[model samples]
Target: MTDTDNRRLLRQLFDAALAVAQPSQCLHHFLPPPVKGRTIVIGAGKASAAMAAALEAHWPDEDLSGLVVTRYGYAVPCKHIEIIEAAHPVPDEAGLVAAQRILSLVQGLTADDQVIMLISGGGSALLPLPADGVTLADKQAISHALLKSGATIKDINTVRRHLSAIKGGRLAAACYPAKVVNLLISDVPGDDPAAIASGPSLGDATTCKDALAIIDHFSIAVPPAAREGLASGRYESVKPDDKRLQNVTTHLVATPQRSLEAAANAARAHGVTPLILGDSIEGEAREVGKVMAGIARQVVTFQQPLPTPCVLLSGGETTVTVRGKGNGGRNVELLLAMAIDLAALPGVSALAADTDGVDGQSEIAGAIVTPDTLFRASRLGINALDYLSNNDGHGFFQALGDSVITGPTLTNVNDFRAILIR
Candidate 1:
């Protein structure tokens, strides 16, 4: 296929992956029957606002009132449910206040009432109400440290769950006798419900000790109050067997594996065989990219996994250990690393993107790489290596006009990566 055709096909595959995870398409199937008394809605994540809107569209017109917090610019309109915009991947004052309101909203609920929670990726950072003794500033500092520490999403969430008031099943617990139904869109490796958005409305098997151990493993300096709370086990997350969560029900409405399958189906429609290399792969973004480059080379040189005219698809959240002063996200960093290792190999091109359409700090989802990637870079005086070293994949791709900017797809199923080999 020509370069234009390749790019179009790759984008189509990515869009197919995103389509399956959209709340409007997938949420109604899993929603519960109308409750006896009141049906309160609550949520936090990049996609929570959209999920709320979808729920409202499907639910019978009744007393459906609640709130959901989403990343800034990700909010969608909902007639009955309120949507609050907040920071993501790191909590801010808006999120803290919203979280507090949610906690208060669930109080004094009876067993007849039901709380519907639209959980998704970035929920952990979207609700940053610190535990009794911990402060929001401490949570923010620790979040910054974890983002740069290269910790897996699971580990980072383990720490956050213990330090927060609403995460790790605490939110559901707050609803006490009320039935809590959580619909989750998995964005972490393995789709472990407990780690998705720190499992705000689901039960957690992890403890304060686990959170402290993760902190020690990363050498993350915790604020004095936070440290004391962890050491004293005063901030332990609600366990799986907690009685308060007995009426809580968890559902995986969308996941990385499902999205990958959708992309694979799309590839088949394009007459390209798709080889999915597992949807739960995780590691440093750059290292994962290098490994993918080897796989693409294998497909080109030897017919091991699959033959030519095939696409290798994978989905999972990858971490970026930011050591350089450059603007880069996990998806772009992975693509840049692949570009460097592939060295503009003929008949090989690739696309990597965060399913939520925001890969890192920037709005760019990711970038597409072609056989002439390095050639074009050289012509433009763009040093790929220097940019990679500074973690500036966004800068490098923007210069090449290859950055995938799809501003807030309003849903997330982690990362979508496709390496097209002809």
Candidate 2:
């Protein structure tokens, strides 16, 4: 197959992966029965708006009224449930206000009433209600530092849950006496409910002490009030057996593994054997790229894993430690690192991208890696090593016109990667 054909196949596999995670496709089945009292819908995430729209479309007869906040440009039309656009990966005034509104909406509910929470990735940042004595600015600073520190999502959320007023089961706690059901789209490595969206509607197993240890380990600069809260253990999240979560039911509506399976099925349809590496793989992005490149080489050199015509697929989140000033995103970094390690090896091509349609601070989802990727870069006077060192994967792929732009997929199941060997 030509390079064009390989790129097209890579994109087709990615599209197949995305199809299963869409709120419209995966949410309706998890909907609960309507209660006698009012049903308040509340959520925060990149996919929450789309999830809310799906709920409204399916349950037209039910009296549904509530609010959901999604990242800007991800909102869909919904008549009853109000959709609010907010900032993501960073907390802003709009997000703070929306979170406050959501917290307020769940109040005053009785046993007959029910609260349905649509949770997914990016919700932790989109729903930023700092705990008492901790300001939003403090949370913002800590969040920025954590992103740059290359800390795992689980670690970042451990701090977020401890510092937030609404996360880590506090949202469910506020809706006491109400039957709370959470439909979560898992973007974390293990699909742990306590980690997805910081477990706003689920109980937390992590503690404030754990949050402090992570902060110290990463050497994150914490605001004074935040540091005190963490050190004093004064801002603990709701524990697993918290009484308020007794009536709450958390369901995994969509997950990275299911999406990977979808991509595997797509490969099968094309007569290419698919091997799912793992859905929970997590580590530094470039190192993961190097390791995956070795596997791809192994497939070609010995065919130990599978035959020539096979696709190695994996799903999970990867991290990047930013040491340069250039634009950096985890998916692109991984792809660039992979391309460099492969060094234009024959009969192998790959694509790495975040499923949410945003790779990092950029609008591009990710990029494609071909055998001639480095060759094309050199022809254009671009040095792959220099770009990688500068943490500018976005710029590197943008120059090649290879960055996959899928504006706001309105859903996220973490990163999707496929290495096709033929």
Q: 190, model 2: CA deviation in Å?
A: 0.6
Per-model lDDT: 0.92, 0.92
Model 1 error, position 296 (Å): 0.7
Candidate 2 RMSD computed on C-alpha atoms after optimal superposition onto the true structure: 0.8
Model 2: worst 10 consecutive residues (lDDT sum): 55-64
lDDT by residue (112-189, candidate 2, tens digit) is 999999998999999999999888888888899999999999999999999999998899999999999999999999
Clashes of 1: 0
In the range 151-198, model 1's lDDT, one tens digit per residue, is 988899999999988898889999989998989989988889889999
TM-score: model 1 vs. ground truth: 0.98
Native-to-model Cα distance after best TM-score fit, residue 177 in candidate 2, in Å: 0.8
Tell me the lDDT of candidate 1.
0.92
Clashing pairs in 2: none
CA displacement after TM-score superposition, residue 394 of candidate 1 (Å): 0.9
